[model samples]
Target: MPAPRLVPDLVPDLVLDLALTVRHDGKGGIADDLDGVDGLARWVAARGDELAEAGAPLGDFVADEDALTAVRALRQAVRTLFARAVRPAPPSPADAQRLLPGAEALDRLAAAAARVPVAPRLTWPESAAPEITYVPTASGPPADLLLAALARAATLFLASDDRTRLRACHAPRCVRYFLKEHPRQEWCKPSCGNRARVARHHDRHRVESAL
Candidate 1:
């Protein structure tokens, strides 16, 4: 069975989770996931508030030493994020590297993402998807394959021939991504839509008065 995608910003959150490599707590014990291999739990720890805000949570669940070390490093970096944000500083190379790890499964997902060629047509057949496409082998699709498939679809939609249909928010401050409801729709929400309408009215009024 395809592993269910965790509902809370899983793509972004999973990226964070993957960056975390769990290890020992230092007293001496194996981690839940990464053994003593030195993994990304620190990154997850650092994003505590972010996860909290996202209705998810980041916890220090590692029991292994190597994983604990990496998690500590990530926590330190995350701690400085807000302070660093005050300046126009760019992310450090190490921080950028955390977004993708060297895992083969992740590499396969990346390759799949690159090859995604489907258009963003939301047509669903009677069967949403087979509960299982095929039996899982060690080399078969990654556990979170449904999300991987969706991620691939999203990539394809962005790269699609009908690129104009993919819209970024018209309101500069709003950072949400959305698809255009109509060919002319620019704002992502009705509130932003209403704001735009008012702004246009003022511009028109000013032009007429100036004439």
Candidate 2:
């Protein structure tokens, strides 16, 4: 039997969930269609992907085929920004604008996401000391604020002993995040495991037939 996926009590889990919501097209790659991938992961990954590629960090992205190069560049930037949970502070306003022109929406969000706390610091770092650590009295805080808050909260709450394990699903087409199971669970689940097994089987059969 497959083990259950690890889902820590992230006050507001964003990056992991958001990145997982991609769907596979008939071809072997991600598709933007939200039909199949709509769920918790979808919601978060959508926000992430929005900021990452569509230039809608504050949830104001508009979909248009206006420019291919610009769109691809935006996505690459997003990926680079969120690759590390503990990234450097958001760029200065001037730098943000320089990195993504006319993308004030995402620039603002990137600044916010970059603020998420990632360390188990006892006292606020001199840098973070100036920042107001806003804890939400209400749930479902704005995505940007939620991400920042979660980062700070986690930093405060976690211990050096309290481990934060990151796992990527083994599925080739899926870049989803999952918590590490209790000494088990290599793939995300039986479904993904079976699908991968079948894919390997078909390839092996084809190769044998050719032989």
Candidate 3:
């Protein structure tokens, strides 16, 4: 079984899922799912349907070292922006001093997004409301197209009201950002919440024993 996640995998935003690729391993260490080209390919494959639905198809896509590098860089920017969005609240430990400055992150995201020029297409079904979708208007390498799509997703998420719901998980060893799904929601998941409570209990016990 997969380890519990602070954020659900079904989040509508790809960038959030991308940012969560870096998470706390169950054994008390940071784990990166996209630590290599193969890992990146796997991650892409897992999200193929969602990416296609979002207007970036990756049919038979294979990731190279360059693609890994590009996606890693974009992930850094997205994570940094996520940290910023949860301002006043502490950011994930993963971002401590490694995050890009806000301005630099913004520039990087914009550059990646501009790599592929896209045009909006309208679609409406008989009983469904009309939706505007952006599709690439220029040819580019699969990596470039994927990067642009991720950057655009990040851009849209940052501009949406959902951004206000972003929060970094504060449970020990957790380095995830989750959307605040409820007014009483604290940690990213129940396990994190339990860990936090247990930690607090231990601290109080220690303090009482010391006194």
Candidate 4:
């Protein structure tokens, strides 16, 4: 199994989770979680249970190499878009264009949405299982369904109030982004905070030693 996430609670949106597929090492380099099809498959599997609960299961769809490539591209676009959005200044025209969903992407989402099924259920007893449940039969290509789900996540995230709190980690060489839950929260997790503090301490000592 892939290693458990270092900061599980930081992922508030699926789009943000997708963007985190690539992370920075704080040593002036970055790491790619979805390095290839296998890497992508692992990433998807890691979230399989959560997706299933959300009514969007992968169901062997991650085996497609082309789908992996497409997902990677979408992740990069989401990162670029959010990076621009969180900056103090307004995003340039080119950046906005990169952020906007293209016609092809929009068409794919529309087609997939049309085929997606809706399952509703009602619980009879509060403590026991639901007396009546409807499990919708899934339709459409799995790859397309995955793409459409990501597109929807991106759209929903953009419209949410949490967008205002979205932030990229400030630690040296750390490229992870997160939704700021607290006003003072900066780094994505405690480890990043410690790393940043150590880097700062080293910088201060080096400057003092030079003097």
- Which candidate achieves the best TM-score against the true structure? 3
- For 1-211, candidate 4 gives per-residue lDDT tens digits of 3222212222255677887777764456666878888887887787776555444567867466788877776765666667655888443222344454545444543444344564545545777644432233566676766665665556446555667888777776666777778889977889989989999999999999999
* Candidate lDDT (C-alpha), each: 0.37, 0.39, 0.85, 0.62
Per-residue accuracy of model 1 over 30-121 as CA lDDT, tens digit each: 23343333333444456556433322323424435543443344333331331133224333223333332324333444554433222222
Candidates sorted on TM-score, descending: 3, 4, 2, 1
Flag the better candidate by lDDT, 1 or 3.
3
lDDT of 3 by residue, 116-182 (tens): 8988777778997665677789877888888988888888778767789999999988899999999
Least well predicted 10-residue stretch by lDDT in candidate 1: 132-141
lDDT of 3: 0.85
Task: Give the per-residue lDDT digits (tens) of candidate 2, residues 72-137.
Answer: 333333333333322243321212232443354356444543543222213346665322223233
TM-score of each: 0.32, 0.42, 0.92, 0.69
Clashing pairs in 4: 26-172, 26-173
Model 4 ranges with Cα > 4 A deviation: 1-11, 25-28, 53-55, 89-138
Q: Give the TM-score of candidate 1.
A: 0.32
Query: Who is ahead in TM-score, 1 or 2?
Result: 2
